[model samples]
Target: MIVLGVDPGSRVTGFGLVEKRGNRMACVHAGIIRPEKAACFQEKLHLLFRSLVAIIQEFQPSEMAIEDIFYAKNVKSALKLGHARGALLIAAAHCGVGIFEYTPLEIKKSVVGYGRGTKEQVQYMMKMILGIRGDLHLDATDALAAAVCHLNTASFRAAAHHAGGYAK
Candidate 1:
């Protein structure tokens, strides 16, 4: 199964793709999409939408996992994040990919074994889990973590079903 994970933001959106085969997972691609700083907010949204659509078309992922919005101190910042997430969701829907959303805490717990894990801890765990070398942007790593979290959840559900346990 191929999964695309997205970390939406008004300025820079991060994306990562992972392919899972059997019990192994590999990073297929990862990068960030940065809109022009000088551009208007609406233009930035358009740019993000177009870029995400292109990515969805190119990767052709079977599903998309996205980080859900967390409460922000600033209302404007939260609203901008909502807009960015909307664009990403629209792109995924248009590409006919299944979408799953996970909270930041859920992703952290799945990836780092702690719901309140620090960013550094999450990054270190991502490198360890993915066997990734070299530096990785924090946003990109978070996106990858989201994908990994989804894969883990799906695996658990499948195993439970096979065992005739609760699965939903």
Candidate 2:
């Protein structure tokens, strides 16, 4: 299965496409999406939405795994994040992709074996897991981690569905 993972932000959004290959995983693509600094909030949202729509159309991923909502100390920052996330969600749905949400805790635990793992740890582990080398932006690494988390959790999610359980 191909999973498109997203780490949403107001200034910079990260995205990664991961495909399961037998017992392994490979990164099909990964990068950050950032509108120009001069962009207004609405323009930024529009650009993000259009960019992601193009990405989804190009990659045609089977599923999209995005970070779930979380509390932020700054209200303005949180609101902008929510707006960005909304754009991302609309893009995926528009392209007919199944959407899944994972909490930061779940994503960290799945990727690093620690719910509160540090970002540096998550970055190091992503390289090891994907057998990739070179530095990646924290947002990009987190996006990749979200994809890996989905791959690791897929089996459980499937079993839960069969057992009449639910996923959130």
Candidate 3:
């Protein structure tokens, strides 16, 4: 299965792609989308939407995993993040990709084995899990973590179903 994960931000949106074969996961691509700094906010959003649409068309992922909104200290910042996320979600929907949302805590726990793991920890574990090499941007790593989390959760659910409906 090919999965695309997105970590949305107003200034820089991160994206990662992974492919799952049997029990192994491989990183296909990872990068960030940065809109022009001088562009208006609405234009930035439009750019985000267009970039994501192109990405979806190019990758043709079977599923898209995104990080859900969390409480933010600043209302304006949170709203901007929501706008970015909305654009990504719309692009995925337009491409007919199955959308999966996960919380930051869930992503961290799935990748790093702790809900409160630091970004460094999550990045390290992502590299270890995906056999990634060299330095990776935090946002891209987080996006990859979201994809890995969804894969793990989906596999667990399937296993439980095969095991005669085991409980969570």
Candidate 4:
């Protein structure tokens, strides 16, 4: 199964794609969508939409896992993040990909075994799990970690189903 994970941001959106086969998972691609700072806000948004749509078309993922917004002290910042996330969701829906949203706490716990794990901890764990030796952007690594968490949980559920079938 191929899962695309997204960390949406107005200025820079991070994306990671991973494919799971049996018990092994490998990264297909991971990068950030950086909109030109010189461009106007509307132009940046158009670029984001176009870039995300192109990625979706090229990868053809079976599902998309996105981070859900957590409470933020800055309402304005939160609103901007909401807009970016909405754009991503809209693109996924248009591409007919199933969408699953996970909270930051869920993602952290799944990846680091602690809901309040530090950013460095999550990044370290992502590198360890994915066997990625090269440098990685923090946001891009986080997005890949989220995808790995989903893959692990989803595969666990599938294994349980198979075990239950044999038990029956």
Candidate 5:
């Protein structure tokens, strides 16, 4: 199965596509979407939405995973993030891809073995786990980590179902 993970933001969004086969998982693509610097706020949102739609069309992932809304000290920052996330959700829904959300703590724990893992820890784990080569943006790596977490969760659920155990 292919999973698309996203780290949404108004100025810059990160995305990664991870494909799972048998016991192996690989990142097919990972990158950031940075709208032109001179663009207006609305244009940035539109760009994010349009870019993700193209990506979903290209990769055709079966599902998408993202970070859930977390408490923000700045209400304005939180609202902008919500808008960005809304664009991502709309993109996924438009493409008929299933969407799932994981809290930052859950994503960190799943990928770094610590609920409060630092961004560096997640970056390190993303490279080590996915065998990713070269450098990647912290945001991009975080996005890939989300995909890895989902793949792990899905595998566990499937195994439980196979053994007639609780899956959720």
Candidate 6:
């Protein structure tokens, strides 16, 4: 299964794609979608939407895993994130991709084996798991971690369903 994971931000959104075959996971691509500076809010949003739609088209992922909005002390930051997330969801929906939402805690635990793991810890585990070299800044790595989390969780759920048959 091909999974696209997104970490939404107004200034710079991070995305990563991974494919799972059998029990192995491999990275297809990972990068940040940065909006040009000095652009107005509306223009930046439009750029984000366009870039995300193009990414969906290019990757053609079967599923999209997005981080759920976490409460923030800064309301402005939270709202902007929500707007970016809305664009991401819309783009994925337009491509007929199923969307899966994972909380920050769930993502962290799946990636780092601890819910309160530090960013460095998560990044370390991401690199170790994917056998990636060099550095992946926190945002991008976090997005990758979200993808890994969803892949593991969704695979588990699928196996359980097959094992247990139908559950209402």
lDDT by residue for model 6 over 4-109, one digit each (tens)? 8888889988888888888888788888988888998888888878887898899888998999998799999999899889988888898898999998899999
Per-model root-mean-square deviation over C-alphas: 1.0, 2.0, 1.1, 2.8, 0.9, 1.6
lDDT of 2 by residue, 1-168 (tens): 889999999899999899998879988888999999998999999999999999888888999999998879999889999999999999999899999999999999999999999989998998999887888888888999999999888977777899999964
Clashes of 6: 0
The regions of model 5 sitting more than 4 angstroms off are none
Clashes of each: 0, 0, 0, 0, 0, 0
How accurate locally, in lDDT, is each candidate? 0.91, 0.91, 0.91, 0.85, 0.92, 0.87
Better of 2 and 6 by TM-score: 6
lDDT (10s digit) by residue, model 5, range 7-102: 888887889999999999999999999989899878888888899999999999999998888899999999999999998899899999999999
Expressed as tens digits, the lDDT of each residue in 1-168 for candidate 3 is 989999899999889998999999989999889999999999999998999889888988899999999989999999999999998899899889999999999999898889999989988988998999998899999989999998999899999999899746
Q: Which 10-residue window of candidate 3 scores lowest in summed lDDT?
A: 159-168
The lDDT of model 4 is 0.85
lDDT, candidate 5, equals 0.92
After aligning candidate 3 to the native by TM-score, how far in Å is the CA of 149 from where it should be? 0.3
Task: Tell me the deviation in Å of residue 101 in model 3.
Answer: 0.6
| TM-score of candidate 6 to 2 decimals | 0.94
User: Could you estimate the TM-score for every candidate?
Assistant: 0.96, 0.93, 0.96, 0.91, 0.97, 0.94
Candidate 2: residue 30 lDDT (0-100)? 88
Question: What is candidate 4's lDDT per residue for 1-168, written digit by digit as tens?
Answer: 889988788888888998888777888899999988898877777777788789889999988888899999999989888988888888889899899888889889999999999878888988888788888888887788778878877777778788884311
Off by over 4 Å in 6: 165-168
